[model samples]
Target: MPDRVYLDWNATTPLRPESRAAMTAAFDLVGNPSSVHAEGRQARRVIEEARESIARVLGAAPRNVVFTSGGTEANVLALSPGLRAPAGPVERLLVSAVEHASVLAGGQFDRKELSTIPVTPSGVVDLERLRAMLAGGPPALVSVMAANNETGALQPISQVAEQVRQAGGILHVDAIQAFGKIPFNVSELGVNLATVSAHKIGGPKGVGALMLGAGIEGPAALLRGGGQERGRRAGTENVSGIAGFGAAVKAAMAALDADLARVGSLRDRLEAGLRQTTGVVVFSSDAPRLPNTTLFAAPGMKAETAVIGFDLAGIAVSSGSACSSGKVQPSHVLEAMGASSALAQGAVRLSLGWSTGPEDVDRCLEAWRKLSLSLLKRSGETELERF
Candidate 1:
């Protein structure tokens, strides 16, 4: 593990030292954040400070930030049926076909009431199809991710918000991947609700927040008991984890511009090297994408074997394909982008992070060169055997 190059930032990031320090300090305190005693007040203060930090980042009021276990819980909390916007209560849920698994689950909505809006061959949501679906629905709750995890394609959120507004619907943005990487302001985008994970930005893995825009109300408690999170979510807060999240958010935003420039440069260098391999196909190359990510594939390669090849070479990359029941399948993201099954099955993702250095990128490129060469050799041998 000493010489390993980790290029899976899209899945998770290493916890920052700043976040670790904050959590360590919080552990010294001994009181439930929901209590009213002096010791409890101290813990409550820590949680509230963390809430304010996240709220400020998302352009939301402190009272509107609801802390949850992680991004998945936050997404589930936001998709509630009782949520109310200025227009009215949402009657159905509409999510893009390319959304994360949690969003595609449709939350509390029944399958009959949920709709999947298609994306274009380039991976952007089809606006016309969305319009047609919204035209007849009664203030549907639309969930869309700000950026795709696998392809790193940035969705047209501002435009999607406008259309939802015109349709008298509410928009929920899963901004987990984009929050720390780009300038993401839920208020500026006119989204009703937005969710982000702490771990994706170098914070603790078990915490996240759901930000409610002004005038949105009652996402209806997913858990009921305590008066925590303004009664929107219950149970005592993970004070230490929230403290870590606050520190991470502060540090990430403070260094946003510089980090982005460095990480982006590394990603560009990596992608350029990757394309030097023959038959490499970089997905969503023509669309706006996250600067830190590259999803690519070549003919005659499959994700499972390539991932193993990269790992054996002292590098860490990921297959875009999801493994189900011990079987590898094509990435839904690429399939939605009109990639053939063979190409989708071969997709591999290499993502950069704040700590990704030139050496890491070079290491990944070297590993890829070896893997690609082996793939071509195997393919050629198969052709010769066929003749």
Candidate 2:
């Protein structure tokens, strides 16, 4: 375990020291935040401080930030029908073909009313097609991720937002993958709602926030119990997790520029090394992407086999999104990008983090080289047998 090289930060990052410290401090506090006593006020203060901290970094008002169980819940909460501007409910749902499983599942909408906007070969949303889709439909809720979790392809969210606005529709941007990896402002992006997760940015899991734009009334409460989160979500707060989320946001924002430059360089080096092998193809290579992600595959090489090979070599990588990694299926992200079944089945994702170093990249490259050679040799043997 000590020798293991972790290259799957996009799945979930290692917790930051700042977040851990905050969570430890929060654990010592004893109070029900909803109570009227002094202890209750103290607990309430902790949550409010965290709200303010996260809001500051995200360029949102503290009132507009609603904490949820995680990105999935945040996304589900945002998908509610009437949570948009101009007073009418969204009658349908339209999501990108390459969205995370949570978004692709079409939260709150019936299956028949849900539609998929296709992506280009480079994994970007097709804006022209989106325009046509919007024109043909009622005021639909268009959900597009700021970045694809598996391929790291950045979506044309700003452009998409403009189209959605012109069509009198609402836009919900899933920023879970893009939150700490790149700069984004909900207002600037013209998105009515956005979802962000803490664990992906070195904070605790089971904690995320939904950011609502100014004057935007969020959806009705998903969990209506204690009237917490200003009736947006109903539950007792995860005080420690929220504290960690706040600390992680501050730390990630402070280190964003430097971390991006460092991780981007390492990703480039890793891809260059992987490209030395024949038959390797990098997904979304021509599109704008996250600074620390690469999804690549060698034809005839199975992703499950390659993932196991890397694990045996003490390097951690993933075939695709961690949520769906356990399943032996082709990546829907790649499939939406028009990849063949063979290429989709072979796709592997390597994502770096702020803690990644040159040595980590070197270790991954070494492991990949061995795996590629073994697969190539196996393919050669099968061909010879056929002859």
Among these predictions, the greatest TM-score belongs to: 1
Give the top-scoring candidate (lDDT): 1
lDDT of 1 by residue, 1-387 (tens): 688889999999999999999999999999887778999999999988988988888989999999999999999999988987557888899999999999999888788889999998878999999999999668789998999999899999999999999999999999999998899998889999999999999999999899988888778899999888889888889999999999999999999999888888888898888877667888888889999989998888888999999999988889999999999888888887889998899999999998889989888887777778787577662331110
Q: Lowest summed-lDDT stretch of 10 residues in model 2?
A: 378-387
CA RMSD of each candidate after superposition: 2.5, 2.8
lDDT of 1 at 156: 96
* Model 2: residue 46 alpha-carbon error in angstroms: 1.4
Task: State model 2's lDDT.
Answer: 0.87
